[model samples]
Target: MPLLAYWVTYASLDRAQTDWYLFWRARFRAGEPLPTDLSYIFLHVYETLHGVGFNRPEAAFAHLQRLWRSYRVDHPQLDHHLVDWLADFIRYYDLDDEVTRAWLDEAWVHAHGDLAVHYWLERGGGGEVPEGVFQHLISYRPEQNKFYRDAEDKAALDTLLRRAVVLTDSFYRETTGESVFERLKTKATHTVERRAFSGAVFEGPDFQYTVATIRQYRQDGRLSKLLTQAVRHAENLARKQVGFRSLLRDVKLPANLAAYLDVHLAPALATLQPPSPVQTPPAPERPRVQLDLGRLATLQQESEQVRGRLLEETEPGEASTDLEPSISPAVPATPALPAAPLAAVHRPPLPAQVAEGELTEVDSIAEVLAGITDAARDLLRQLRNQGWEAPEGDLRLPPGVFTSTLVDEVNEAAQPRLGDVLLQQQDGRLVAVDDYRNELAFLLGTPEPAALTPPLDGPWGALAGLLSPLHLEVLAQLLQTDLTLGELEVFTTARHALGSAVLEDLNSHALDTVGDILVDPYGDPLTLEDAYRDDVRRVLHASGLVHPE
Candidate 1:
């Protein structure tokens, strides 16, 4: 309907001119009859007759008469259709009649009076059959039975005969107080004793019909598609394994379908193939960060700046004679009054940390250490290929880094890694944001360098942890084997940590932390100097970083 509407709406053709319509137009206009085998007519007649029964002669006779009237002798094609239709009409109807009479004959063989047949025969009222018609039925039935038995083909009503016996066995058991099984056995024995086993009683299983088996029996072409669909359903249900579906597609049964197919197909079906496996990828490498205070001094001077500021104070009255000794500023201090021109100098963005002038003796030392720290971080970043080269000059640090209270803040921030020792003598504040990268060896305190701890992560008694991340890794590498400073730099590269370089450089400067120096790999009583040298020797031996011996 949608197709029809689409054509009507879009194409708006005056008429359909497909081959069928065009040919039909010529034939009708020319007064030519439709060919019997024209696609339409054949389908029409064949479809019309499919379910019309041929169970009786009268039925076929009526159909034949109808066809005769419909056929026109002038139209040989239509006449030919009637002829084929009649031939089929006769075969089916006659075969049905023959089957009905044969069933009756089996019940009344010899002179056995079957009240059912006599009653039905009398009701059929053919007036009088031929004198020996009853005899003929008897003789024909036995003869057919003989032919069937001789050819081993007496299965015509094998199902029906079994059905009748089942009914009889039930009747005998239910109505006569006899066991059904015993009654069936008794019937079978009598038949054999009478020497009448041709199509006789025997042990036969009750016949069951599946829709598929019925379709196979009929050999129905249209039903074949439906059967194939059913087979596919079975196959899918079993995940396309063998067994029932395999036997269903067989042309005919051999021996027994269940037993044979089970033997062949069950095992095949049971062995279902599994899906294939998938592969996984490898892990990525970690980032490397190592600090070096000495190399940093090379980048920017003022190693003492942050250390100086760390001790400086911003609070009122904290500046003393030692720190505020006659200092001058670009702007004068506010007059000693609330309404003065300005109460405080709105200082520019202070040094990256603290003001150098505010620094005290202890803060001065911390500021220098802080400067060293800043330089180290810078150098490590550069090594990571940040590509920020240090400008050549006196290592003067940038100013804002030394804001009045800022350097102390930085010292406090970096203290966790460098330790409270780097803190001002007054308030030992920790400020290292990421202290994990600091030299942990001092935190876990020991005379022996090997006693150099990794990091005090948790309470692990007697096992002092090194807080310096660089020291731990470099130590780990040295533990692997000895290495040198120049070589230690290469070890730093492979370790992929700027922290490794940071540890090596600290030890290299020999001013703080372990370095590329030599000592017992074990925690032998060695100063930072000796341990530093041992690491340097190991790095050298490993041919890690290239430099003169």
Candidate 2:
């Protein structure tokens, strides 16, 4: 029968009526060369078998394989169509196992590369295929295929890009002994194939994987985008290093690829110049008060004379007897008080009431004041006369002396002996803390002001007096809220003291006065005992060391 007649008869027959083997055998044996347009026959047969369902995939695949092997040589043009249909049959029947894959490749995988890739990808695109086959499959850029075009595939691409960066960074580190990624260690166990690229060979077990992945992107016309991203990533990795440009220059890539990276990375390199040193403005000059010493002496003499004249006019009889010297030689006259002595005043002799070996509290405070500079005494005197708070300008500071420094000097001297800051600067005014007002007045020889808060009596009062200023400040902060050792250190460190020592001192004093430790020294966050919290608070409040909440 004519080829056309047989083809028509085959199409007309149902599966039950047709003998696939005998029918094709007769045509093959006819010896009239197979027609170039025999793909219809292959398609018709594949459809017929597929319609029979995949209940017997092996039989169906074997039948298609037989037809392909039988006619593919005579009808070379039909080979592409037949192989495609057979691959589709194998895929549709889920026969894409090692057996069928070998069968399909032997049939035509070499001649039809795209179909081979499609077949492989349809099988989830994993496992080891022939290297040449893999190259051909990846060469087609399967990631752009509709089946692989999703976030998962994009992530795969990103993963490959990152591997490339790490490999490249590893290459630089190995060749130049410098790290581009700043990684101290690497998992690159594979020795570099020295001649693989132009400059340096990258490391890592994934080197072959990275090469294939990169080749796929390169074939997909995305190499530039990939390299640009890689260059930017490397730049970020090396941004903090002083040798970024050198690191980039040492990147082990082919000349052209390295040049491409350089072009993209040049703009960032230009901006990476070492940062300029910051310039600080100089402090402004202070105006020095140049005093006329002779004129000051004349003014002082005039002021004293005016003061004596006014006193005589107000009480002539008392003034006469007080000012006149005693006539009798046997009875010595009491020496008059000296004029306002700014320069040559001496510390008062220890009071007779103070025992020779022991320093009384008043004498100790006086000693603290006596150790301070004349400027500090003057500042204290002004604060005392002005109700313990006065503007900085009214304090009569000496030339080149600042009110803050003088106050610090006085507080430092007093803190060691008196155990508290005698003076503090607030709102540009020198002020004495209310708790120390009486002591400050007596130290400066000023009349004592009425106490703002009455003194704490009994053990609480004694404990308050015994506690150092740092201890009180720490206690005050704890009274508001319990403090950690770190928080307490902030208060003590400025005073060159330790928080633990302050607590120890406080507990020691509490033992002596309250007969029990007030603060729980072993607590994580130091806390006062519940029984003594109120009493401690009351003592601090009454002494004006700490105020009511």
Candidate 3:
């Protein structure tokens, strides 16, 4: 299956690398070791970070994280070839595994502390670490390595390192205490020789020396360039394999026969073969034979009566007729079965069915909304009172509107139910979905509310109708974190428009739509730059399918 998928995506190198990664991931899961060739893993990591493999880099990070965790269970130490790439993966994804965190910390302390610390700092860890670890993070110097690259790259790197140092110090001081740096220094008094000043001297030629040299080359940032070359080589090999496999699948030939022809007959077939004239064989006369015509006629009549009797048994109401007495004729068509009843038609379950455990078919919108939680009901009231009006349809509300007024109120909204009631606009506005408007009015006891016939298309279809593709994607992302306007600006602009000017226009248009969605009916309208949260995510898991409470 992996090979077939690889063939389908043969043209794309990134996709091929992703396939190769998954192929190995399965092996790791089954307690098998990975291939010695590190090219496949490196390419997968690189492609995933760049968002080429697996469509989303986050997904790629997750896959690699699982693979690493599984592979490390039996192995005591990581492969030397994987350290740099693994470090890059960790930096890009900010992985949270405790084992990985400890491994990275130890690896940096014992291996290339100077080079790895930049990535560590840039990634920005969430939790606290030992004070000595911060000292190592801030104090390491790249220039200590004799094999370090020239001054041109060094200057830029040094500037970055200085910035990282300041950031780390500030962060620790703020999070810990004013005397944290001094405490770190006191803790580092014992291991000063091991971590701080150990690798300045050159070791003579040996297996360990060779390993150290290779590690230096990688730390100096040369391995990534070599990995790119390896990727091209692997891609070339993959293309040939895919081409051969495709030929085999399409030719409908046995594997051995195909191999035999390619090996022995291919050269011979290359040269044109002369056409040979066809030969005809003469016909020979046969001896005379005789049959009784009266006996054959009697036998044929008996056979027809037997077939007619069998047909009568199969079709009770229809009368069977005798077969025409001939050697060959066209066959008659069989009778069609009766159509199925309307009740047997496969119609989807109504909205009432989806809400069966928590809500009833006849429950009012106010009652359902209130049943979710007090926070949820309050969120709806805020939307109803403060939501902005769309140009042509219902009022809309952005997540930010709720977030600005009530602290953590967005977490209170049930996305499943909210998705039932709120329609998503292309610009990411949540307008009260029109499908439930009448149902809601009825639920709220509005006088003379128009009777609404529940949609027969089913609950899922109705839910799908409430949001566009982009809305669903954005909502899913929001379940993880509140998306900033700058991120949204980049995302919407890159995806929806072509030119920079048009992208800017679209960005502005999106902001305007957001304003309409979060109009704040009783106060000042909300801006796009304001922080927004997904209330549905508060009640739902990352899958966005199951409600946690």
Candidate 4:
């Protein structure tokens, strides 16, 4: 089902309105709340975060939080629950997982893109955005084509995108840079190819069996449209092979005879002498002529048999020997040894008071206003002192015309903190430069790296420092660590049941099964077909349809 319910709402409600619309709407809708729609949106939020497990968690949470905050201000009625959800987000954040990055890749990064806008209008806000306050909250992703965008509150979507890039880069470094793919192939292959080169294909199952399996998947909605297409292709290829076999069998030709005939038969036939028209010597032929009807019948029977076999031909153990063998991916019958319990990933079960934390709320708007103003002044001084740093070959930011890149770009209400920044640029210069650049810049008059210390702030700060938008993604990691360490029996039981190898095992499994299940694109962009596969998987997993495998 779609994330939001389809309501023929006012088409023009595209911006955040501070007016008491949510309050009145809540009263009007009352019991008939948009539960399914709300849940759908949450699931999308959840699914995207789950994909971040392929990357980072804290970063992911930071992004989600930004979105939650932006979308929830005018949605004050939902804020209480949403805030709780946000807290939970921090609780379950995992630093190394792709769940965090997944949210951005699938949603936030593209939130304001034109496509997101259209999606929101055509899909999301069947209801309109309220009419006031943070009206500009609605941004468009030209990337997705100009469409009405969705925003409940006002936070910077561009900021979320920048943070997402950093988180993605970090994930790439962790999962790909230092022998990740090699290790995955190495480890996954080692586990998968245990019965290596036993020369078995989808052992025991014949082609009919494979075809039957695919057909069943289609019937059960387990196979997506794309996968169905692939299955059809495979079927077509098999059928063609059968046709070829039948032609060869009936044509009474050598193994290569068909090709030879196709290539040379016509030319050779051209060289043949025309039929002689001379009167026949009839007497000699009439003497011994006898028709073998029985033999002809036997020959016809043989041809029919050949055709039947050809239609159901088998290629033996050719392809799929190593990929998904007939015997399950990992034999459930292996009688897995009761291994030590792995740690459980959890919502911060720590008492709310304890888990609640010291990252003081943005305190008050007054403090934010002062801090933002001071940061802006300090930033200007820093900019002037540092001078333009854009490379000459690159399209340059004109000298002295300070571009609001990172913290400087943020309004007086949202100055980035030390840890909140992953990276920042100044006139195309790295504002939050890395250690190497910090060292180089320090030597050449740059400032000290703010994040050189362990990330001291909350997940949001760490995200800014680290660069991510998923709210509390860092906290999620902390929670995951505790979860892994906690001798929780439930976590162990869950992992065993799901057969997971990662912290976000259930989330991963959700992706695994749901990732392949897609609604018909119904003539959408071909590239989106791939993205939709990813999206559906994430959504399904988040919704708990695809359990962890």
Task: Report lDDT (CA) for all predictions.
Answer: 0.31, 0.51, 0.36, 0.30
**Tens digits of per-residue lDDT for model 3, 1-549:** 122111022244466566666777567546675753333444343444444546654565556555555444443233332343355555544556775676666555323322233334334632342232333332222343211222234433333333333333444456567422332331111111111101111122211101111111122222223222222222222223223111101112334423332343223223322223335677787877899999999999998987676655555555445365423223787888888753322222344433212222223344355544455444444444432212111223444453323323332333443323233333333344323433433343323333332321221222222233344444444444555545654655544522222222222222212211211111222122224333233312332333444
Question: How would you order the candidates by lDDT, starting with the best?
Answer: 2, 3, 1, 4
lDDT by residue (tens digit), candidate 4, 153-240: 1133222322222222233345457321122221110000011101111122221100000001112122122222222222222223
Question: Root-mean-square deviation of each candidate, in angstroms?
Answer: 46.4, 37.2, 28.8, 38.5
Please give the RMSD of candidate 2 to the true structure.
37.2
Name the candidate, 2 or 4, with the larger TM-score value. Answer: 2
Output the lDDT of residue 378, model 4. Answer: 48
lDDT of 1 by residue, 239-273 (tens): 33322111112122223322333343344345443
Better of 1 and 2 by TM-score: 2
Instruction: After superposing candidate 1 on the true structure, give the runs of residues whose Cα lies further than 4 Å from its correct spot.
Output: 1-272, 283-313, 316-549
| Reference-based TM-score, model 3 | 0.17
How good is model 4 by TM-score? 0.16
Number of the predicted model whose lDDT against the real structure is largest: 2
Global CA lDDT of candidate 1, please?
Answer: 0.31
lDDT score, candidate 2 = 0.51
